[model samples]
Target: MPLVRIKSLPFDHEVPVPQVISALSQAISDAANIEQQHIMVTWEYLAQSHYSHHGQVAANQPINTHPLLIDLIAPNFNTEKQIASMLELIAHTIAEQVPIAKNNIFINFTPAYSDGVYDEGHIVEWDM
Candidate 1:
């Protein structure tokens, strides 16, 4: 359930996605004290001028010249304080590319019951 998803801003500048991923993996692993194997991270780009969701600016957005969208998902649930901390860990991973405006980033943590999710199209673990 500890998954880190990172999506970069839609900029022509080729972000060292691999380097950034390593940094994120390290940060999240340290913060959660968990192995890197359980973590999942991804990066996607969105043009500032051409991207808008629900008539509103999307999360992990760029407010200026097409900022990058960086998202980190963990096995956390409920409350802004928790989300904020997780975002900080993730933001620290790519702090070089993102500013600490608090509004420039977004984070989510959903605790999925292992039973609710599947592996190889089978409910691997549903017993308590």
Candidate 2:
């Protein structure tokens, strides 16, 4: 099981949630070599007024300095090179979908033991 959670300032009207989700899932699946069916992507938008950076509210700013957080939980751990490649893919995909600096994107990968991740009441396990 792999869960991808994207957290950022409230999306503007132009930001298409479905497309963003699809792109993220596809990018992650391809980069991580994971099955698309096992990947889950979700997002939560925070009001700019409630999200602050350097003690300043980002509500009225044209470009938010606040970082976009991408949390990924997967059953398998990856090499540092693999993770780096995945992060690059994620940053590019997100930037293409929304207006955010690539440097402001932060992706955290958490590796889950098979026993800890489940789907449809069945625990996740490596096929090979």
Candidate 3:
């Protein structure tokens, strides 16, 4: 299972949450080499002013410096190439719906215990 969090500067306008969720799930599944049904993704939009770059507020600028920040947690058995592929897919997927540049996207992945994650007192299993 994979849990993903995406944080980005607010869009010029609103975006449908369902679309974002679907796009992310598909991209993450491709990147992480996992079944799409097992991936979970959530996102938030932050004002540029809420973040900083080199001690300067990004919101004061006309352009965004750090447009996207992604946090992902998943099993640790993926190969290096698989991880890289996932990041690339994530960036491309977000860019297809947002105006952020791929270079400005930042993603961090955490290795998680396969059976440690639980919801409602039941352990999450990779049954598929």
Candidate 4:
């Protein structure tokens, strides 16, 4: 299953969680063709003060975002590139609503293998 998770490091800003989720999921579903029911988008809140590490400006830093990273496991790994491309729409939608920089939103995709993956409680070949 492909899960979309959003973690925030806001800097002295108060954003509506419902707005973010609504915009993000709509954009993701439209771009990725994943039904709204199947698209699992979740987010966690973090204060600007909490984003600091060793006392640095890393928290809620918009300049450090990467707008491309996607992981789609086989037998659908081929969709990885397309999925990565769709992130921009998601980022842009969020940016329009909030102050999140398009560039600072980084996404990563990983294709998992036989490393503990099973089909219906058993190892079997599946095709759709």
Candidate 5:
């Protein structure tokens, strides 16, 4: 399972949040070659006043200055190339679905050992 947490200011009113989440989840599922149901994508909206850039509050700066931060946590089974490809795909998908500039999107990947994750009432164990 892959868990994605997207943090950013609220999106423009033109795009529905649910649509963006669905697109992101689908893109991750496809890039990771995992089942769609295994991917979880969530967005955490940061109030403009709560975010900062270069010591300047987001509310005081241009919206473009605010960055889209993404945290991807998944099993540590993927190769380096696979991880890179997955991040690229997710970034592209976000750019397409949202108004954020591609450069302003940042993704941090954190790999979790299978046994470290608990799901469905038990620890996760990957079948080799």
Candidate 6:
């Protein structure tokens, strides 16, 4: 499973949050060759007053100045190519949905050991 967390300023009224989430989840699943049901996505909106870049608050900067941060946590089994594809897919997916530039979207991939993940009341085993 890949758990994706996206943090950004609130999207415009024209952008539906649920649609973005669904698209991101589907992209990750396709990139990783995993079932869509195994992918988890969460979005957190940061208030413009609370977000900053180079000490300038988002409210004071031009629109889309603040970057969109994405955290992708997954098992440590994917190849480098897979990781690259996932990052590309994620950035493109968000850029298409939101007004942010593709360059402003930053995705951080964190690898977790199979034994470290807990689900369904027990630790996950990749080999199982």
- Among residues 3 or more apart in sequence or in different chains, the pairs in candidate 5 whose N, CA or C atoms overlap within 3 Å are none
Pairs in clash, predicted candidate 1: 4-41, 5-71, 6-42, 6-43, 7-43, 7-44, 7-69, 8-69, 9-68, 9-69
Q: What is the C-alpha RMSD of each candidate to the true structure, in Å?
A: 4.8, 2.2, 3.1, 4.6, 1.9, 2.1
Candidate 6's C-alpha lDDT? 0.81
Tens digit of per-residue lDDT, candidate 1, span 1-128: 45666554454445577777777777767876767876777766654545564465544444442234554444324256866766676755566644434444555556556556554568745434
Instruction: Give all candidates' CA lDDT scores.
Output: 0.57, 0.77, 0.73, 0.57, 0.80, 0.81
Residue lDDT tens for model 2, 20-113: 9998898887777788988899988877688777787776323447888888776565667876777688788988878887778878988777
Candidate 2: Cα lDDT at 5:
91
For residues 45-97, write the lDDT of model 4, one tens digit per residue. Answer: 56554565435645453544522222223234436577556555666776677
Q: Candidate 4: lDDT over CA atoms? A: 0.57
**What TM-score does structure 2 among the candidates reach?**
0.84
- The digit string of per-residue lDDT tens for model 3 on 19-120 reads 977988987766556788778898877765898766766653223476578987777776677667777787788777766667778899887766877854
Give the winner by lDDT: 1 or 2: 2
**lDDT tens digits, residue span 70-122, model 5:** 99887798889988887888888888877777788889999989688998889
Q: How accurate is candidate 1 locally (lDDT)?
A: 0.57
Q: What TM-score does prediction 3 earn?
A: 0.79
Candidate 2 local lDDT, residue 62: 33
State which candidate, 1 or 6, has the greater TM-score: 6
The all-Cα superposition gives candidate 4 an RMSD in Å to the true structure of: 4.6
Better of 2 and 3 by lDDT: 2
Off by over 4 Å in 3: 30-33, 60-64, 125-128
> What clash count does candidate 2 reach?
0
CA deviation > 4 Å runs, candidate 4:
53-55, 58-76, 112-128
- lDDT per residue for candidate 6 within 71-103, as digits (tens), equals 988878888888788888988888888777888
What is the alpha-carbon lDDT for the whole of candidate 3? 0.73
